[model samples]
Target: MTLSEQIPSDARIAVVTGASSGIGEATARQLATQGYHVVVGARRVDRLEKLASEIGGTALQLDVTDEDSVAAFTAVVPRVSVLINNAGGAKGLAPVIDADLDDWRWMWETNVLGTLRVTKALLPKLIESGDALVVTITSVAAFEAYDNGSGYTSAKHAQAVLHRTLRGELLGQPVRLTEIAPGAVETEFSLVRFDGDESKADAVYRGITPLVAKDIAEVVGFVASRPSHVNLDQIIIKPRDQAGPGRFSRK
Candidate 1:
C-alpha cells in the first residue's frame, strides 16, 4: 500500500531537520500539506516558528551540532514515522592543501555525525511505527568531487554509505530508507558555506537556473508518498543547465 494509505492520517509524524529554510522548509510544508504532522527543527527558533505557523506544524529548536540539542528535540517529539536528515553544509571552497582543519571537522560533524545522532535517537520510534521512512538529503557531491570539495564530498559519501548500510540492516523491517541528492540548488547553502558572503552565494547560481528548494521538496514528497513495497533507493535532481558536478551551462 502507498505510504499515505499505510500511515494513519492523524498519526503520521515527520521530523525534518534544518527545517527553517531551503529544502527542509519546503519539505516540511509539503509533508504538512499531505496531512503529516511535521515537526520542524533548526537552530533558528524564530524562523522555525514562522514556518511552523505558516505550515501548521510543530516547531522545535535544534542544533544538530550539539548532542543535547538533538536529544531534547527528539524527546519532545514522539511517534516520528519519518526522519529527514537535512542539517548539513560546506564551509570553505579552498583547495584541500590550503583548507583549514576546522572546516573539514565541521563538515564531518554536521554531515555525518549529525545525521547519525538524529537517526540513532529516532530509530526506536521509527521501528515502533512499523511503517517508518528515513529520507536523507545528500548532494551530488557525494558521487562526484571537484576542486575545493574534499571535505564536503567525503562527508556526503560517508552519509550516503551510512544510509545504504542502514537500508541493508533494515531489509526486512518496515522502515524505508532513501537518499535525495541534488546539484546546484539556488539556496542559502552557498551563503552559509561562504559565511554570509552574498556575492559568493550569488555566484554559485549566476548563469544557471539552479534547482530550487521546492524542486527538491516535490521529489521528496513523491518518494515519501510511495507504496511501502516500492523503495526509491536514491534520487539525483539537477537543473537542466547543469549536466553534472561543476559543469553548469553558461550562455
Candidate 2:
C-alpha cells in the first residue's frame, strides 16, 4: 500500500523530532491525546520507544544531523499533517575570543541544517496532507543576543528565519508555519548547556519560576488545533518572571 493508504482514513499524522525528552516528548504526548497518530523521532531509542509505547504511537530512530537517517525516517512516515522541528540545542557558552569552533559547528549543524533536512525531506508529505502545520520551537535568543551565547543565539536566529521564510514561500499552499520562541522553560536545557554541571544548571533558574516543557507543548497543541485557515505566524512564550534575555524578575 502507498503511504497515504497505510494510515487510517480518519487519523492525522503528526511528526515530532527531538522527542526523546522535554518539549518534544511533551508535545508528542499532547498531540497523541488529540487523536493524531504521532510519529516520534530521536536519537535515544530506549526513551523514544517508551514514549511511543505510552502514547500508542510509532517511534523511529532519527538523527536529524544524518542525511540517511532523516531520509529513512521520513520515508516510513507516509504522511505528515504536523511536523514539529524541535531537534535543536545549545552547546558551550563562551565569548567570541574564547569561542570553541567545535561548539559553533555543532550548534549550526543541529539547529539550522537539522531543521532544514527534516523539513525538506517531509515537505512533500506535508503538502500532500491537504492541511498541515509546521511548528518550530525556537528560543528567546532567536531575536535577542547576549554575552557568551553567540553560538546558540546565532543558530536559533537562523532557524527562526528559516521557519519564518517558509510562511511566505508557502503562502497559498496547504501548509501553515508557526514559530514558537520560548523564554526560560526549564528542562534539560541548562543542564545540557552547562555540560552536566548540576550546580551551574540549577543556578540558572534559582531566582525565578521558569516555564516547563508542558507549557510550550500546550501552546503547540493549541496552534495545531486551530482551523486550517488560521495561521499563527509567530508566538513568543515566556514566564511572567522573564522580561527578556537577561531581564528577569527574581523574587
TM-score of candidate 1 against the unseen true structure: 0.95
- Top candidate, metric TM-score: 2
Per-residue lDDT tens digits of candidate 2, residues 133-250? Answer: 9999999999999999999999999999999999889989999999999999899988988899999889888889999999999999999999999999889999999999878899
Deviation of model 1 at 12, angstroms: 0.9
lDDT per residue (tens digit) for residues 1-251 in model 1: 43335445566899999999999999999999888888899999999999988977888899898999999888867588889999999999989789889999999999999999999999998998989899999999988988888989999999899888998898898999989999998889999999999998998889788889999999989988999888999999999999888898976
State residue 195's C-alpha deviation in candidate 2, in Å.
1.1
The Cα error of candidate 2 at residue 164, in Å, is: 0.8
Local distance difference test, each candidate: 0.90, 0.93
Worst 10 residues of 2 by lDDT: 1-10
Query: After best superposition, candidate 1 residue 182: deviation in angstroms?
Result: 0.3
Clashing pairs in 2: none
Which run of 10 residues does model 1 get worst, by summed lDDT? Answer: 1-10
Q: Candidate 2: how large is its RMSD? A: 1.5
- Top lDDT hit: 2
